[model samples]
Target: MSDIDLDSARPIFIAECRELLASMESALLRLPQEADKDRRDSVHGIFRAAHTIKGSAGIFGMEDIVSFAHAMESVLDHVRDGVLPIGDDLIALLLACADHLGQLVDSVAENQAQPDAELVHDARPLLAQLNQRLLAVRMQRSPGAGDAPQRKAPAAPRQTGADHWHISLRFGRDVLRFGMDPLSFLNYLQRLGRITTLVTLHGDVPLLDGLDPEACYLGFEVALESSAPLSAIEGTFKFVMDDCEVGILPPGSPVADHLTLMRERARGDPAELQRLRAIWLHCASVAPEALDEIAAAATKPAPAQPVPAPAAQPAAAPAPAPATVRARRTGPRPGEASTVRVDADKLDRLVDLVGELITASASATMAGRGLRSAALQEAHEALALLVQEVRDSALQLRMVKIGATFNRFHRVVYDAARDLGKDIALEISGEDTELDKSLVEKIADPLTHLVRNAMDHGIEPPALRLAAGKPAQGTIRLNAYHHSGSIVIEISDDGAGLSRERIIGRARSQRLLDPGREPSEAEVFALIFEPGFSTADAITSLSGRGVGMDVVKRNITALRGSVSLASRSGQGTTVTVRLPLTLAIINCFLIGVGGSVFVLPMDVVEECIDFIDPGANDYTELRGQVLPFIRLRRLFGVQDTPPRRQSLVVVGHGSQRFGLVVDRLLGETQTVIKPLARLFAHLRGISGSSILGSGEVALILDVAALADITRAAMVSRSPAAAAAEPVHQG
Candidate 1:
């Protein structure tokens, strides 16, 4: 214990604090939705979270966290015990406290031991509210419990000694080496209760030659008179338990407890044993038989073995799993297996190394393609399979369920609804869907904006909703699922949907639309994503001035993803976002456009067809449908004539389909996505570059962006040009 690196433990402490805070928030939110037993359970859960945080913070000597969380814990304890009812105001206050705690925990991560001045100011009023509630409840209960004149009396008035608690503390020899002060814990003990008796012992002190100045060799016995709960009394010494031995006896403990104390302090010294016995005897009277038994045990010549200390408390409990729509068993059963939490950066390094292994494996397979030996080919094939498995396992480490991320919105909806004075309920589904952890983090802000926008603009006011024959309480849905090897997230609201006339009117005013041309509904909806595009008639804190939605689109686009909007006037609106499962690697269909090779995400590639000459028309008929095509050779500015034999690779992104004309189809391959250099970041229709096994570079085409570009080009082309090839549909 003395050699433990306490500083190293800080990171783990901060992480645990974050998880506890999240649980506290969840429990608080549930309180309003639940009732009876469920509500009571929620209150208990909240109490446990606050108590654990306070105790753990004490161990780390984070006084700010300890004090703030202690105040919250007191309020929660009263709520759980039915001294105070759990009401809307109390729930809101607890949520604020949880938020403050989260900020404090983050401060710890920032290497600030104490919370900042602003946090202190915010917390002071919250703490006052909690303490005031506690005092009010106590005052209300006092008259009922203390002034009931007709209540039945006990057998006799309780004795003073019977109401006091006895505490036994023995300092470890190396307590000081652990950076803990034994006296500090004793000082904190007085804050919980009045101390009636205190006696210190130095029996463990060594001879001068053997003594070490840094080592602690002290112990104390104390009698405390108070009405605090046992858990609270035990928590006072939580920080020093690792460096000392502690035993707590409740009021009116048995004579055997005092006898055991005598033997522990004796150390074969009769005078020292008698002093301990006298201390206990003076604090409380004992029966003659009990005294004789204690005397007999103390008189026996005990072996010279040293007394053992009580077991220290366990570290804080691991956080509960994220609240899910359904419950399932998690983690391993006894005797099965266990897990260790690794630093995220280390896991990322491992994933990078695995990616390199994948590239190297592809290189080997390329080298072996020329080998005639069947055995060598078989070996290379087997190696490829193993490498693929390893890559998959490594990637899985970064795939976390989106449920935790989704759960965060509960609080967001709760707070935003209150601020806007709207009755909005957020319904979430498919939360168990998993995505790359990095994507989960980067997507949070964009999702936040979408959620807020939906609550503010998408959901109509309660009165309007009711007048429109809808429920007074509006509903906003966040749903996620995997489609075509990509994750699709939809934020939809049951409110007055986008007004096409208003949007087109606004677009024309902003010159986002052609002067005298009317665009289709799809094209009109797409204009909302353009910068500074909004149909809001007024400005407010949440929306207005055309901001949030455009940013959401940009951020999603930056991730090589796509966003689209669909709405029906007076019905509802849904914003759909599509993103790849992982950014590190993907399966790609390789193709050759003139002298260069290109990769198209395999999930989006529908099929390849012969590139028949459509005679001055870029659009061709495929399966009885007029399909627009973008010639890669021309789009990439490749200085080469079209190949005699070419193929069009038809790809589908979301609801749109388009073709890429290339010299030949190169089939499928595992593509390790290497990001484009900063210099090429602004390049259009190309997301990233990849190194092939043959040491060639292949650019990974952005299918979604290319589809958009093809549609835009068709929209801009002259009517005669687009109609050069007859439009057909099955």
Candidate 2:
């Protein structure tokens, strides 16, 4: 009903596969530090994700894709078992395999008929090594500790006589719903032979009232006549069965004798077997080896020791428990709970519906402002309240935790620091910070650049650090939190801070600064954000490109956010990023500028007060705070005369504070953002616009940008700023 194209499931598969691949890459990179036994979980998670995609591909009959994924999965299985040791070289090979698998998946998803043969050829060498190891191990021993494989193999090769084999399969009580799809194996059997007999067992089927439709209730005793080898039949179920409970008993068995045994076992059910015989006569008999192969698969491995110890005696304590292996044939890893696939577009539609509901409720409240009936008024108020709750609940669905995004920095830091040969440690904090999904998606690029720069430049080389009387291993700390109604992410390095002198030299050499003017330390750091500026001594893949950090600043700005740097020469440098909690709705204080109304975010507003003190008239000595204040009317060239008493609004960022002079302080208003038109894109001081009750638009002031401009102006001591009148209000 979703209108999703079933054939297009490939692209979804590709995306999910890529995410799984990244997870695997990250997990593998962490393995050296992780104890081997503790890695089973990571291995299992990766294996299941791959296995699911492969099975889905098979349903579409994607031959090459299925075969390739199976090969990679075989390698992962070896890693899962204790037989193969995981090491750096093997992990590197697996990583490469993961990447290729992604490409193949993408090719299939995009409806490209075939994947690149070059990729397959490139991967052959590694797959062959894996195969060689598998062959080596298989050749060394038979299944079930010497007996299972030897007996099963000799019988399998000789089973070519008939096309059908009678199979009676009774699964263990614990088999998962699809754990033993007698049908999947049956279908594979049918591929080789014809199904001559089918007897469905209803004994295990529950009373109609108690039955679970999803549960497999019926078992089968089947008779198939086919020419396929016994090995193919055995391999189909190999992934699942510990005890197959199968009997090859193909069509060529002594007719009279087999019938007598079946009659005895059936206890008077003659009709089913009689019907089976009629179908069996038309097809070529199944192979004798097939019968034996089924028997071998059905048998369980014998216990090392079958006797139990006496309750009181320590009876020669058993050897350490071997890692238990329980093989279950499953199409995919079980999910947290059963779920149905849904298109993202549908979810977006639902969100939009909820937004409209909120808008309608607001409209209704406005329309019924003076309703005379008590009952009607109460009804309207309750509906408005319910709609408000619904709006919040809908938006919360798009709120995702930042933990996954934060954890990826571990691998990035590890790989980059090693490439630079600098010993550095990445420390993470506050991964539980929550943000809008859109913001999380947009922020990944900027965060990556900052982390790469820290690893490549901020951290000193190990030997250099030791000689400088510091810890040999430096640390890069990523911490985030919700502060002042905004999300703050801090990436700080406890290595040498920004080299002020070196940065200034690089900027001057690159013609990014005035020829002979001395730049302050802060100014020197700020210059790094100028296009094409970097302080690296040599060009390298990680940092010498000189193309990343500046773009990082610009992108953060575009997010209605701000980023700034704070460093102590030898202490450390921290890049602080402050972003709005949500892009959609914000609470603001309305202020008038040049006859047009604008809004300042309430979170950053410290206080609003009227100044009566005559000392406030001077540009100094207002509450002992020396910071100069800017008036709204004058800054924007508003020519109107000022009101008798002007209100001062104090805004704070960290320890800094400044005042804005406005004609009036309008009460708080809740509004939703409406982006400005593209032509006015360079509107610097105004970040965004929102609609008012009267259908008028008010600009949202960019507080952080304004603060930066104020700081820059104060530092420069511009002649224009000094010439203007100041209220000295703080």
Candidate 2 lDDT score at position 152: 20
Give per-residue lDDT, candidate 2, residue 371.
59
lDDT of 1 by residue, 1-730 (tens): 2326567777877888889889888888888778697886677668767877876777677788889987897777667667788888988989998999998888778874656667767788888898899779778875556411122222432233356677777877765655455765665465566676667778789999999987888988776777877777777765555566676767655555555556655657777776666656544333333554555556667645532222331223332221111112245645966768888899789888887887888888877878767887889999989988888898899999998988999999999999889999889999999999989999999999888888888898889988999999999899999988899999999889999988888999999988888897779999988899987788767788788788888889878899998999888999999999998888789999888899988899888888887866778778777788898887889997777888888888776777888898889878788989989989899999999988899999988889788777777678876563333121
> What TM value does model 2 have?
0.70
Residue 85's lDDT in candidate 1: 84
Please tell me which predicted candidate would have the highest lDDT against the true structure. Answer: 1
Off by over 4 Å in 2: 1-5, 8-16, 108-384, 470-472, 515-518, 611-628, 717-730
How do the residues 1-730 of candidate 2 rate in per-residue lDDT, one tens digit apiece? Answer: 0125534555565666677767877777677677655587677656655665566555555666677777767667666655567776677677667767877767665654556666667777767866876666567665556311111212122333433465555554433322234555565455455665565566777798997654555555665656655665555455446534444454344332233333333445455445433323322243332333223322333224432322432233232221112333444445636455556566556666765565566556556765566777788889867765776776666667888788888778766876788888888899989987778989998999998888777888899899889999999999999988789999999877887778877888899889888876668778878898877878877887788888999999888888888887777889999898777666678876556788888888978888443452323335545555566676667887777887777776544567677787777755666678888678777788866655567788878777776666666675554444242232
TM-score of each: 0.76, 0.70
Name the 10 consecutive residues with the lowest summed lDDT in model 1. Answer: 319-328
